[model samples]
Target: MSSTQLRANDPQIPSSADGSQGLPLLVLGALGVVYGDIGTSPLYAFREALHAAGSPSVSFARLEVLGLLSLIVWALTMVVTIKYVSFVLKADNKGEGGTLSLTALARESFRGRPVWILVLGVIGASLFIGDAIITPAISVLSAVEGLEVVAPTLAEWVVTITVAIILALFLVQRFGTERVASIFGPITALWFLALGVSGLVHIVEQPSVLAAVNPYYGVRFLVVHAEIAIPVLGAVFLAVTGAEALYVDLGHFGRKPIVVAWFAIVFPCLLLNYFGQGAYVLTNPVSEHPFFEMQADWTQLPMVILATAATVIASQAVISGAYSLIRQAMHLNLLPRFHVRHTSETQSGQIYMPQINTLLLICVVVLIISFRSSSALSAAYGIAVTGEMLITAALLFVVMRRIWQWSLLFALLVIIPLAIIDVGFFVANVAKFAHGGWVPVVIALSAAFLMQTWMAGRRLLISKTRADEIPLRTVIESLTKKQPLTVPGTAVFLTSDVEGAPTALLHSLKHYKVLHEKNVILSVVTSSSPFVADNDKIFYESFTPHFSRVIITFGYMETPNVPRALVLAKKLGWKFDIMSTSFFLSRRTLIPAAKGGMPFWQDRIFVALAQNASSATDYFRLPTGRVVELGIQTTI
Candidate 1:
């Protein structure tokens, strides 16, 4: 059976939960988390366009500046405002949004399992991870580079300071950010306010720059200078790089808050800044640093400090988003489980994953040391963002047709234009392959390979393991007749396959030759929905005198506590006491056989991953003293 089919048959759906606070607070939170990446883009996006335009003998005239500004404004309007806020956010899966959530929702629209859709989802997730790594390195590098404007002598210290700051950021992750997180929203709001005030000052000087809001300037520039514009489009593409964060972080902040924050604060501030930069550039033809040049000398240092803080905030959001994405992937069996720590008492979304944080920090440091400047890193940035956007557009098309059940013509009307624009951005970025763009492509391809291998290897391992095990019913009947020595306390055997006798139970029966006074077979299931109803969380059935079966279901978004779930069994007339119950778990040691499911090399990779997976004792929050792990060797 397909993964989607298995999920469909797993559990019951719960009522949608509205986790929103008041509208004002929700918008404040959205500004900090959802808008950080895109909000900080004004720091380098316009500068990069100017650099791209001036290179290779292209003239960056006043009309060219206007054209680029118009393009920037319209791209934000089309990609972020219309596509994400107006359409994609409305297609959430049980009030949750992201590629995986959307993938699960889209899978339900079709009658049969579609492997292609699953592959698309995997590719999109891999690309997002690639962006996560690049975002920190580039954002920090760009922000710290602002020091050069304040003191030319400090240019030499930019990379060192950036690396130090990044190291500190990752190191503090273990302690959690709950204490300082409250300030992120207010700080980002102030940053946006500063951006608008700074830009409006310059924009009033050159009123003609406001004419760029006309979309005609954007189309005319592209048509007139198609050759120059084609390459510039790659640089222009940077303006909307973080557009995907809106949908990726939809679950953390509800739709209403994000939409309100975008229309009210983020969109207007970005346009004003971009227009301000354009206006400054038009009057001073020879100036390269228009962003800092327009700022008065007294405010320049403060602007740099605020820009650095904003970029740090943006990097934090990307890191947190990665944790959420990988957690979902683990629940879906695409990757092995890592240690997940809930940092906040009231907020379940505030999570810390040490392994992910460490790996990302190492990669970000390497990128900073190698690239050395934001200009070089910028070449590596757009490709991953555009590729992810393309995949999202493809998935969105399927969602519009299959889930929303729109007419063919209507779906085409909405998605075709987006597909064309996304494709244009992606094709433009293809030129970056020779100039450091290969970094994210390589990272994304490696991630995709690992996910596919792990998923395929899991299926094979489960099939092989199940082939060797007997039915639970058969074992129970024989045990009842034979009547082994009865222990005093209750025993719970954790199993992936509820139909068959658990490997741990079989080992316990074969070696110890003892059955407890009360034997409960427990199976834990993860569903595709965000949350399962409490009423449908547990199911129980009695087979023999002392034997029974219980199943507990948890949503992908929740952390499972096995013993706590068992406490609910009292409602069904089963006397349950955590002190009296001993949990039995199977610890599989995979051995690669010549005639096994996967190729020998891939099997080795799977084995390495399995060996590194977090122990179930910690994952399920089971008691350390009462749990017994019986190890078994399995050929796969």
Candidate 2:
């Protein structure tokens, strides 16, 4: 598919208004949240860069420092700014972005083996869940690690205060972050600009330090200090940790604005400050300024406050990103379904998932106690970041071939370099497994299991229902007729797909044993895309069996709200109010049954997820008072 053909087909593809205006906020939020992994790298990026040599005592040459700064700058420019921002963000699913949305795209284009694409998609999405598990722990723990720097004696209370804050963060999550969210962009923007301003002061003071960008600093450091540099990559990689988060958040910001913010604001500021830190260290090697040390005495308190604000914003982004990821996971069959509340009345992007919040809160508390310092948490961060990156690269390859239709030569040229960087990061991060990095790997693995089990369980349930299912045509022919059993009202059973067995329809007919004279529509909600068009949504067919089936389509980005949909579809069908209609919902209960049975472990997994899964009544936004539930038992 050429870009022109893709656009021609997808007139709803995000335009400049969406990418430029909406994306910055989303990008900022993601940067704020995801950056917690790396934004704090300045605490270590340069300090560790110098330690790339055998000791911190080496004579700091101007060239070495400049080269390191350039590496940081170019890495951000090439990786974050160019590779993802300029390209990847364009790959949206009906103007939404997430791993599964990309998966949906690949599914539509590949049109071949779906299981392989699903495997890759699930791995990538699950890795983010792993990050959701670790980010709060590492992020808050890292920030509170600052107490030791700002005041060493307060270090004893770091764990206590950090845990308190994380607990409180989750506790208040239900109230929503609208008031706080508005300021996320401005605060982060200031943090970057302030960093730049502070760096410029130091850079002018030691102009010679700018030469470190000459490549020799990074190159020579690797050559002369291979032993030390081996471990240092772990820390340097942290500088770009938020880089992937920016791409993950593409749905919020349309890629263009995030790209602008990165190039015009974020990139320059981060580089200037990093080099400024290098400059500060070059001139006064003995100075102990983790971040605020570079500031003048009068400015230290404000800087501390600003840094804290920025850190919180960064953490907030991760927290919110967690909610967003969990929602996507539920929709895509990667996780057990859960209650997801749209928190922001105005912005659909603002969402809340209680299950994830509690989980994150617990993990953060544990991290604060176990690690007690950012250094310990650093080990666990790499695998989640790079593993997801590799998954993204793999998906990107599929996108280029099937959707973008880029030539094999071009795809290989791009993939080889990304693979090298991605694999190196994965291998290096593995060295930290003993330290605490195993935690995220464990989390990601568990998340993947939960998701896979739910999907497997659901598939099994549907298959069993089909086996027992009386075909609609047969049922209608035998039972449905113009007779004394004519019911005064209509009963509509909602389904996800048309062909499969509908337990709801079976339950409705079994219990009621009547047909309405006016209108009784068998509605199936389809994910609207290339398969179906929005205008041609209200299609119906009256099989000779007296059953009129209606299939309605909605885009991926559109959250299904049944009542609103009914109203939109009113013109074509019976008036919702006058129809005297009642909606029938059939809920599934997971239990261990030898009939249609899954493995024992899988059974337990489904039961667990089913227990946690959100009620369908709430998810559909159907008039709660009017919904009648028919519970169907299934052995997973």
Give each model a TM-score. Answer: 0.96, 0.90
lDDT by residue for model 2 over 96-147, one digit each (tens)? 5667777778777854757888887778877887776666666566556665
lDDT of 1 by residue, 1-636 (tens): 111101112334433334546788888878888999999888888888787777623446888889889988888888888888889889888888888888887877788858888898899899999999999999888989888888989999999999999999899888788887899999999999999999998899998999999999999988988877766788888889888999988877778888999999999999889999898888776665677777899999998899899999999999999999998898888898889988888677788998889889999999999999998898998888998888888888888888788999999999989889999889888888889899999989988998998998899988988999999988988887789999899999999897999999999999999989999998999887777766677787778668888888888877788887766677676788888989999999999888777889999999998898888888888999989999999888
| Residue 104, model 1: Cα distance from true site in angstroms | 0.8
lDDT (C-alpha) at residue 493 in model 1: 96
lDDT of each: 0.86, 0.67
Evaluated against the true structure, the overall lDDT of model 2 is: 0.67
Output the lDDT of residue 416, model 1: 89
